[model samples]
Target: MGLKSSQIKQLERLYRRKIAPKSVISSQLVKDLCTAAFELGRIVGLLVNRRGSVENVILGDATRLYLPDIGRIRASSQRLRGLRLIVAKPKKKQRLKAKSNMVFRPSLYEIDHDFIVDLEKLRLDLVLQIQAHVEAESKKASLAIIADKGTKVEYFRDVNNISFDFSQFIAELEAKITSQIKKAHKIALIKGERGAAILIGVYLKTQKAWKYSLNELKELCVAAKVTVVDTEVQRRLKLDAKTVVGQGKLEDICLSALHKGAQTIIFDCDLSPSQLNSITDLTDLKVLDRTMLILDIFAKRAVSRAGKLQVELAQLKYSLPRLAKKQTGLSRLTGGIGGQGPGETKLEVDRRRAKDKVAKIEGEIETLKRQRRLRSSKRHEKKIPTIAIVGYTNAGKSTLLNALTNSKVLAKNELFATLDPTARRLRFPKEHEVILTDTVGFIRDLPKGLINAFRATLEELKDADLLLHVVDATDQQYVKHSKIVEDLLGDLKLLEQKRVIALNKCDLVDSEIAHKKAKMLGGTCISAKSRSGFKDLMAMCSQALWPKDIFR
Candidate 1:
């Protein structure tokens, strides 16, 4: 996801410390930071208002915490004093009692930043006497990149104070940032107190997902049930974490989370356990990484009992290694994509209980697998040729399956529609029956851990007599998608298997044009949505899997 140890150390040599800014913070960092912030805002519509710090950003809802950038100390327009020690506001329940000892987390983004101003204790009386200023609205401040623009300088304002649209502000922010750091090639992302869940934007594709790529990653957050009050992306976003964005941007994310009432910050990229803890410490919000989101979707779509158990087992194994980070907020951790676990603290005995539970579940799955195999063997004994449909997520494999066999599988325009291997028997006109199985979708750079975990399920593909490689015709990234699937199949050691590439969504493109593409590539073309080319696809399947001698 980032610089190798030696390379990072070389960078440290230039800066003289690990926390010092490196070349990585200048190029892609701001973009990634904006993404995280947008995601945070989407999940929780909080604000990174000026109320957070003295003329700086404060992120809190029922609880308010202070934050400064994690980098070098720099002079600010705001005033500071020696006596102004940060403290949490008194709760309604605690107003009658003395305020207890509590820890207040300041900003970690500006780790190099701290104030050494001198002020008398009398100043604390004046400030703390009022408790804290209740800001009707936070200040929306503008930052000039006399320095680095990749740093999404934080400011808050009352919504009534601003006249301009937030999106325009973000576009201009990117322009100003890039213009400031024209020489720097890398970007830096500093979210939360520390940079967490950051990832490099490989191959700067202007388009994302389908051809229409989102300039704002906050869109993913909105999709994940987060809200968006405001977002600003500085140019030169840095990729510090493989999953989370940056620190400066994370403040905005926290702000958005508060605004939208989102308790969980789900990253599009996966976060390691260490990184997860680091971000949570800063934001005090549950952090769900990219893998967790995928797993969550799996958990939701798992209708079959075996499918649910398999996903649960994989999720438990994935979470167990990460239990060390989940100390104070284990009960608060709800089952998002990443939070699939027993919610039990691991005492010495708890570990044994978990291990025993895992073994017992595995034994049950083994029994279930035997039952599945018996059914497969019965089908195999009858020699009803089987075909497995496999492709990148949302490539319309389920739609194709539904169209081909008249089965009622949920055919949504979403990813991972089919988790279980759904098969229905289809009899060819020549009196030959074939079994069609719909399996999980593939993606680029699928993790080795998940691949190993889903091995039992994926092995179902290995027994197939033919592979129906479905490609989304409407996808401009089909070339890259095709390569990813090919690489996965090669890794699965099924590269030599006989397969037919079914270019689905032909209705989206002109049939003549799609068929021309198919003919040129020597593949089948069909529009599962429109049924424009389904007959040709079926004929090809029958020709590929069955002999003509029986009908003749």
Candidate 2:
């Protein structure tokens, strides 16, 4: 006789108590089983007694088992005795047949002895069987419930409940499944110290210089106090505009980031608003690009009011375009009193506020610029020539300034360590006096917003009598770095100013290489920490900033 719904429920309860605990049965498996049973219109279950014997095989459909090959074997003597084998039958007319041309039968000998079925394997086999049958009949995949281990039984109860709302159940099931997947792939918070981040980059196979850029990005992250736990790189002929890296490559990165418990992802190149949003959506981590990292370091190091204003302006300008709209389903729309105007998204409100703040800060900065121009005029009136030290970030510009003037400035091995301009009185040989000013360091691909915001500080360079371009002698890309700084100075229209090169950190490189670099850069090599070549550097500076007549 066909098993009724109540009997099938009893079988499920028995399976949960016996087979599920002994095997790797999950809620998904249970849901798949129920779905397959419902679609086939009949489920077959094997009821095995406690003594490991086949008892009774029950089918949801009342079809009789036909085993012509193994005429009814004696149930008492068969090895399958006391064990139940259940198979769901389709409500339609098609019959079930194994590959061996054997029609399914409830008889024990009809089952293959070669197959040693466990709960997990049995569940998979049943699912495959039902899927094949349904696909052949309907030509479409079946929708199955997915639940957690703790909630599978409750879900089944809800499905069977007289007042069950199938739509509500499906909605809750989908949400639960999504939440479970996200939880499985969720990034863990770093335990102590700074949060860990994954650094990712894309490069061309022919571009051997990509490592240098990635290294610079790592240094920038360090400056911002982020721990780079791992780095991923993909060599592609062309970059993917949507995600920066190829979809597969990005998936690998996301998996690695999850494994490493990283909370952020840092890209070597600046990402566009869409690209940034896409990557963030895929990875579910805080995404930062090179420009943002540099801006963050500047924000942290900015001390003076003018310096803070400039950093804030740059940050706002950079972030204004990257704001993403909130999902409507996740947000409430309000048009009542004290609410944002009608039809305006929270993202729009944020962007508007940022724009207003940018405008206000720009006005304040303009006032500061006038005050700075007046101060420069006063310095010029005193006939005190100024020497502005400039170079690629962390090239030891501030260190050189401190070494030459014997004054303390926050000199670190990090990039963009100094944001505020500091000028010290430097007396050269023969009583030649000049003001040596250390301006903010330059970097490759410096954001345009930062340059515009710091125009007042960079104005010191335009008024300088001579430029002391500090170069890190130990840097492998020192030549490239020198060119970048020169190009930027040219852009600032300070290329016409007289300049002297101070190749600092000479002690970190070979003497031969240092000499060659100094000759190539047309600068004097000096170890700022050791003060090895200061006398020559000072002599060169005095000669460039002050004429022989001034010395006399």
**Top candidate, metric lDDT:** 2
- In order, the Cα lDDT scores of the candidates are 0.53, 0.67
- lDDT tens readout by residue for model 1, 190-280: 2211112222222223334422322223433332333333333333344556225566567556544432333456554557877676776
Report the error of model 1 at residue 396, Å. Answer: 1.6
TM-score of 1: 0.58
lDDT of 2 by residue, 1-552 (tens): 455787557555534433322222223333444455555465544444433232444444434322112222221110222222333334345455557865564321122221122111121111111211333323112112213431111111121122334334434544554565345334322323356788988887555688888888989987888877788888888889899887767765654554354668888888998898887766556789889888988999999999999999999999998888555453345556776535556776687799999999999999999999999999999998898999999999888888888999999998888899999998876666889899899999999989988987898799999998998888888889999999999989999999999898889889998999899889898998998998788778767765554432
Candidate 1, residue 200: the lDDT equals 21
Instruction: Supply every candidate's count of residue pairs whose N, Cα or C atoms clash at under 3 angstroms.
Output: 77, 16
Cα RMSD, model 2:
14.2
